[model samples]
Target: MNSTSSSDSNGPKSFSVNFNQDASSLQVGCRNGYRLYELSSVDSLELVYSNGAEDSNLVERLFCSSLVAVVSLTSPRKLKVCHFKKGTEICNYSYSNTILSVKLNRSRLIVCLEESLYIHDIRNMGVLHTIRDTPPNPSGLCALSINHENCYVAYPGSSSIGEVQVFDAVNLHAKTMIHAHDSTLAALSFSSSGTRIATASEKGTVIRVFSVVDASKLYEFRRGMKRCVAISCLAFSLCGQFLSCSSNTETVHIFKLEDPHNSPRRSVEESSWMGYLTNYLPTQVTDVFTQGRAFATAYLPFCGVKNAIAIATIQHQLRLLVATESGVLYIYNIDPNEPGDAVLYKEHRLDAVPENFDKTDKGRSSSPQNIEGILGSYAGIVKGNPPGQMSGTESDKLREMAAAAESPPKGAFQFSDDQEYPPLTQISD
Candidate 1:
């Protein structure tokens, strides 16, 4: 494993960092406002612009371009859109309730409130559509595809259970709704082409991928059993071949997408025998047979840090950049063909050295100390077995897996069902 630390004294305590779609730049939000950094150089982060302020809950550089947006969580919650090159505000919007999340592409800007979503045209900030009475979302569980031509947005449906509402990027019209799980939703992500979307519920045991065109379940990958971990982020590779998910745990689970047309079929003997037994076998048996099949997993190389909140894939490589609450970044190179976990490629702190260091350090010690050793053991990535597959007592694993695979009621989305439909309350003007 590789590691590095920052000498900068003003590093953020807690930060929200996002890589532009192509991983060319990074937008960081912290207690001291938002800063845009160029990621062309691997050795150092070059500051491109700085919008200094007191606090910001979220900051994103849209589609890896010059446009940047910020969401402040403080009183009089506001959304500020600015031009990164000019450092000028293009549009500023305020809301009565806290702005839970903000997402944007070249054509659209999506601002998510607690129970509503507003879609606007990026050029003029004109409201295109408003979705109301969304699920009780506290973490702002929403995802927007990076593709411009076939862009899609996904958020929790207006229900208490795991329902996802997908909308088209061009007109913000509801395309389809997916009943993903039986619990509250945790995270949602769209494939690179926007043809498929992935959903993870608050239970966090299973991840299901669905086709956006028909809203049909495509694949189900087991994440874990026994524990209900919160998934913080989900990312799809640029080519739409692989998916990576990170949670409140140290390890990140990667699943290989099964291509319906090109996937090889099992041999006649293998399928006939297995299929016969699978029908009689319990659901737990089927789950165990499929556990960790055609997939590889990875873990954080170090210990004593929080789980990763942000994850992004580097184009044309098996590399991933993971960011934690402690302001540390981890780079891992995962081999898709291999069954083992990912290996640490490099690690560094996001902060840089203070500019006036030389002047202030003249009378102090010159030797730098190891930050991890000095800080002792704080809450960090706990190293254990990588997530996915069954663990612990056999009985416990069977019980949890059985619960996770239970299906939601059929035709529950119909009006005749008892699913709660809260009135559509528009909070944005």
Candidate 2:
């Protein structure tokens, strides 16, 4: 969801970076405040807005919209929704625990905690539903569909194994459960269409793609056989035709979804040693070799640092954007037809402000938790119908009903589960 790393004690304090849903923009949060940049082109990163009043640990933009969701490191339990252009706080809410991750789309906003999830209507910021007692997700890892038609939210279904629970944010129910891997889950992502979901386990040797509708396995990719890597990000291209994965290593792997054999270049061949041994080895042993390999790879300047990556098409060219927590953005160009190593196009420093950028408030208007044990109180109470096509009237009604519901308080609350069944239950102290 976000990449954070510490610099030298004499250097600037820690900084956090995250890309917008489509990777069209980048947001960097630091000890002083946050900065927003628009990927106007491959050669330039336009500074749209900047704020220095408060310390922001996390800041997310809603597809270039003016609204932004922010969380301060000093008060991680509190979430503030603000209108960046107007510099006004729209609303804020506090949870019983620290907020780990937050995801947003056109229709819904999802806030993930250690063992719970809160779904809010984007229109009114009203609490639509709460998924309590989830598996202990210390990373606060979760993914939301960009397609508002079938807005699905995915999180680790099991703490011991790599299981994914897909929730229908629009319909407000659990969609299905996917047994993604044998090891614990490390990363999760949804295709642009919301029809498929990708996951990687803690082992980080394999990547799996599942059909969101049936929870059926679609594609499996073998990242490496030499070592176990820590996968940090999984992203699908806007066209949903390609998937890119990044890990703690220096190499970023890219895989094609359809017609892999037709690629101009590939990492492995059927006539190679693994291919020859496929007939002699056991089914399980040979299956690893049969799995797909990287269609293309990108090498980073440094490894083991926190970074975020995304795939996008800019100026009719496929691009890979890697933003490292060390305050640098690396842009790579990839030939879709010829799949191999990615070419580094340009690199931008996020820590530096451009001379032409405005520093005044009057400048251009800018675009912008929980305990595991207490969660056992209510387990299966959260369920939902399979997401079906909703009529316009039905969709509007759902939004209206959500907007009419009572909203949480506009500030922080020190909640206790014993005093209230649900942590957000408003009670006067």
Candidate 3:
């Protein structure tokens, strides 16, 4: 189904949108103000709060909560913390350089500048720690895991070869540093459990998942090799079993992690031969054999798509919310057990403004009157089943597919240890 927002002459020229942890609340930053809407239904939008601002560049709702922080597109960027319910500005903090990114949960708030990172206590807005001389991160790329107790943050380590600096979020102590890739870094993400970190380089062909504790490499999946691509976002499933990545292309790829705890059992005949042989081999040998295996891939539903700007996944569900540069949001429901790509479930146009949108009235009272219907149109698109649980049949099917896909084709020549492996090649979508 298709729904469009009415356009007004005074409407925002652009928009910056963010969704809460569970995808329940959506906060949109526009040129004049930021709007908070409930995403429970698509037929109507339930406006929770609306705050007027001048040239707002970013609006982020705190993880799993209603309190929000906003940043304006002005010099010496500052972040304003406000109550989403009362529309009152509780506090505001200023920075010397332009703010690259801001991340917050119930306990902490993280702000990234060009060469530094500031960690602040959320309760009283006290400065917890400041990391200086950080790697040059122009995009302001940083990731915080969902785990509260052992919260972990991952960011670029140096301006040299690609490296990731993982640290304790609470005490600001250095945990481990991973020399992840050869080219410049593109993105970094931490798993939901805060145990692993995923890194991609500017080459964008290989994505590596590393252990947060020891800085050891765990899994490496290949995205493409023919040409260099810039990765925009990387997200780990809530269960920490799958990693999803979207690049400056029309496709999104999902890679499965090696989880013996939840993996399906192998067949008796195959397990006796291949599994037994591989079980006795060193881990280093096994990793070389099993690199670059992607579970599934899908393309953006829109034609002439520029790129995927952001990606969000629901816990225990195979659904994905993908946002594109054209102000379109697509919901994809994927079946990992199946061998094919993900299918588009629904689509919503996010840039639509209300008919009576008044840019002159710069106050909270200027919120769209038909908010329920306007916001519902975008929220209702995601109304459906929550994340699905894997059944025995599906698990078995996935195992069979993974085994077949990971194995080399019969009669294919194998490279000797002394021989160099051919350059990785990109497969067409």
TM-score of each: 0.73, 0.80, 0.70
Q: By TM-score, highest first, what's the ranking?
A: 2, 1, 3
Q: What tens-digit string does per-residue lDDT give for candidate 3 at 1-429?
A: 111222312233366766654455666776667776665554455555555557667777765343577888873377776544434454466677788888765556788888888886654455668888998888897877666566777788877789888879887799888899988788888776778899998888889998888999887887876365778778777667778888756678887776534444324423566556667889966654446556777766433332333334444446666655445566777675764577776776666556564434422333333222222111211212112222345334433433322343333312121111111112111
Which residue pairs collide, candidate 2? Answer: 113-369
Measured on C-alpha atoms, candidate 2 has an lDDT of: 0.77
TM-score of 2: 0.80
lDDT scores of the candidates, listed in order = 0.61, 0.77, 0.62
Pairs with steric clashes in candidate 1: 304-380, 305-380, 305-381
Error of 2 at 219 (Å): 0.9
Stretches > 4 Å off in candidate 2: 1-13, 260-280, 361-429
lDDT of 2 at 225: 81
- Which of the predicted structures, 1 or 3, would earn the higher TM-score when compared with the native? 1
- The sequence of per-residue lDDT tens digits that candidate 1 reaches over residues 1-429 is 321233212233477677666566667777777666665554455666555565777887765444577876573267776544433344456655678888876666788878777776654455667777877777777888767677788988855889988988685578898998898788888887889998888788888889999999888777877365777777777767777887766567887786544444334423677757777789988765444333656666543343433334454456666766556666777676665677776666755534643422321232232222211111011111111222234224333333222232233212111111111112111
Number of the top candidate by lDDT?
2
Model 2 Cα RMSD, 1 decimal: 11.3
State residue 345's C-alpha deviation in candidate 2, in Å: 1.0
